[model samples]
Target: MFGLFKRRPKTPGVARLEPLGVDVTVPVNQSVLQAALEAGVDFPHSCKVGTCMACRSRLVEGKVKAIRDFSYVLSAEELKAGYILACQAKLAPGDRIVLEVDIDSQRPHFPQLTCDGRITAQTALTHDIVELRVAVDQPLQYAAGQYATLRPAHIERAREYSFAAAPTPGGDNELRFFIRKTPGGQFTGWLFEQSRVGETLELTGPGGDFWLRAAEAPLVFVAGGSGLAPVLSVLEDAARAGVARDAVFLFGARTQQDLYQVDAIEAIAGRWAAQFRFVPVLSHEPADSDWTGARGLVTDYLAAPHVPDLAASHAYLCGPPPMIDAALAVLAAAGVADGHVHYDKFLDASNLAG
Candidate 1:
């Protein structure tokens, strides 16, 4: 080996900050938030997982790289305006930036920790859908419409499920999840066949930034399969808060048997019938059955005459990517503002592997 000069720590990745006029340097490989924290600057962060855009800031001078995986939610114009998520961005040397501290301070914090929980109850909502109730060792506070990662002990695999249960009054320790069996999914197979009451499992909490925000706009919920989880959570949370805004939930399935939680939706509608409506859409039901509700694709229902004023309503969608794509187009065509349409696409890696 040839003798060579050693590399210096100040070579490149170090961030040279010019915060509010004061200049300083930070190490490379650290996110903007981490750099701020190390520099004694307070920055707001939640889910530190790059999913929440709460830590967004402006990249005034140098380039920054995103640290975590994320799907872009901001438009091209926003990026052109220098807005970038600090949690996902790594600053390079010579980067001069001004932090939007007010926006960052509003993000809610979620602790990252693994805990053990026991399966208290499990039930089949439909032929292939299962509802699980677990009691964790400690209380976990999470916003409705978020999700958790479930990993069985000694198992190398994990699954993500949305929270369907409403947050207990004053918050509680029990966690609820709604899971649908994907044809041959590894975790789903194990869950369907071997998961039983009293079985212990490991889970990571309160993931996802898809929770509801405070707004007076009317809301529409569209979902299919277990995508109904987060949608149901939003609706229940809204009803619990006594929100009087008009809301409609359009749940779709292949046939009558594929539908789950109809009664649950009906119950919520009955309680908030004055401002809420539940419509079940069947895509491939038998003609013999006397179905009086909406029929055909869920997108069709959204295009119907009874749809609320799109300009003042917010739309929430959760389902397969194809359905979400179509729903977005339909909503846009119906005059819904692009910024008001929020969605979470359920893409299973196992499905891709097959």
Candidate 2:
């Protein structure tokens, strides 16, 4: 009878973050990143999935059970150095853990804000892409290229989308996003199938570390599908700041119809103090179409006789995992340093499941 009353083994259920000196509870089945966000740790992260390595941190002390394989995104050196993605880490039968995080000090940390937002407008940009403009009840402040997590009342899980433009100074009450509809996506399916313009949404955010860095080097922007959101935001912020660095934007799409925001991009280029070029590469455009622009994959045009020298440029890339991988290979071969390349990989439920 006493055996039935024996106590269960205890887990520390605690994660001690270094540098910031914050301690947060890690509940069973909850990731370390989620716990930190709940405790207001201001951890840098995007795409809560394991794809974007933004939530990576050093596991200084303690073992963690990873939900996914880290070999895909993290390098062998990083793995050897004990770096782990907080979004995929869970307490693994251990005591308290000590983690070293690199929180960006360049910009002031904006506390995670939660507010009710109403969909003010919905404009279809492509066959599967939609631009959603939301007006929130309170002011929200965030750096350009950051993303927000939005959930409609009917959806069980919220999805993250990058801000499609720079925010108004002194915190703006309106937010905008470009969302691509995933065929089986719960949120995107609902958004595309119904008129959600007047519907209220639960919004939380201003998350992510995919912002523009201060540099004098020329900029190389590569984007695919709806991944152009943050790229556009960064360029807008640069234009507003009067930073006249030469830039070349290589945008990729399947067909001519997949291209969007052309006039808007041209407007940005119009005010560019230095040289600016926008190249749209269509991978599968019809052979009979009068498309005189660049054809084939965007990676094919990265070499000379195609685009200018990229050896001294800073590159920003965003897209599906495959596209990002291909672009990274091309960029590396073109002499672009590893540190100069920043990227965000968009992942859906299928990726999370994997």
Candidate 3:
């Protein structure tokens, strides 16, 4: 019955290479990046889950299937321009392909890391949010907005989550993460079911380059749902370092109930109130409630007067794809340079590794 959907026989591995200015043979089912890595070719990549378009390369020739649905990552124009993600594309047998290497100095370095940590504390931040604090056997250093993968003991799956804790005064021993419960998510489901204090969970080191850069530039941070985790860490780190750069944080949610860590953020802002602004935007609220804050989509609030002059500011956006896309358009229209806008879209494991 399922034979109708059977895939066609795959072509044999690469037979030759000429357009790429190098000779290399890529195996069937191996991605461009994987093949390049094996051949000692240096390329840029982040997230490796097709979420970050950092590894985007122009396909001068050949056809490839994306490992994941990348419609959300690239626009119609970009797709038309032959921009394919190397991490998500496998080389077609005997297909000649051209790779355009990014020469930008800002490209992130992808490192392989392995570490061990135990869940020291697991507390419910909200009904759907859980805060997990882990203490590793040995300290590990990571940038403020970087992320790590947590693999629960005996579980074959791992989940990616951003940090919510700033570097301790002079050490890297403690790490914190704010995890949101996704319906039917494997790790999230396990996190909600068996996660407890003192249970050891294996972890990988810093895997993201989404940290605070350009300390002197004015900063605008917009976060939705669990996206606040990394933003919180950056803000806290800045505050601890006595950074006086002007910064604003816009946290958006569906309702007051969806907001978390308000008091903590407010406290952090208080430390540098002269240079920090924290605003909570709600999409829906009780009509009878006495709420006077910005009410609309987070992008709408960003378009308001409170949003700073993006020309001289760096913007960090973290949220679902729709929210991030909307915010990117708004920021661009407000004069923010494309290079100054950074974002991370949460990709479901099923949607990525599947």
Specify the highest-lDDT model's number. Answer: 2
Q: Give residue 12's lDDT in candidate 1 (0 to 100).
A: 33
**Reference-based TM-score, model 3:** 0.78
Q: What local lDDT score does residue 58 receive in model 1, on the 0 to 100 scale? A: 66
lDDT of 2 by residue, 11-122 (tens): 6478999998988888766899998999888987876778767888999998888889887888999999999999998885445799999776774477679899999999
Following a full C-alpha superposition, what root-mean-square deviation does model 1 have from the true structure?
5.1
| TM-score attained by model 1 | 0.78
lDDT of 3 by residue, 1-354 (tens): 556778876764441232346655667778777676566554555567676676777776678777886677888998998888878887666676666655456433444356788888999977888899988877676677778889877778777888887766444677899888887776777778865788888988665657776547878899988889988888888888887888888899988888899999998999973578788999988867888887888878774467666667789988777788898888878788876888877665325331
- Per-model lDDT: 0.72, 0.86, 0.76
Model 2 weakest lDDT span, ten residues long: 345-354
- The count of backbone overlaps in candidate 3 is 0
Per-residue error for 309 in candidate 2, Å, reads 2.5
Candidate 2 overall lDDT versus native = 0.86
Better of 2 and 3 by lDDT: 2
For lDDT, candidate 1 versus 3, the one ahead is 3
Q: Please give the clash total of every predicted structure, in order.
A: 0, 0, 0
- Local error of candidate 3 at 52, Å? 3.3
lDDT of 3 at 349: 36
Question: Residue by residue across 282-339, what tens digits does model 1's lDDT show?
Answer: 9998888987777899878885455666556789888877788789888878788765
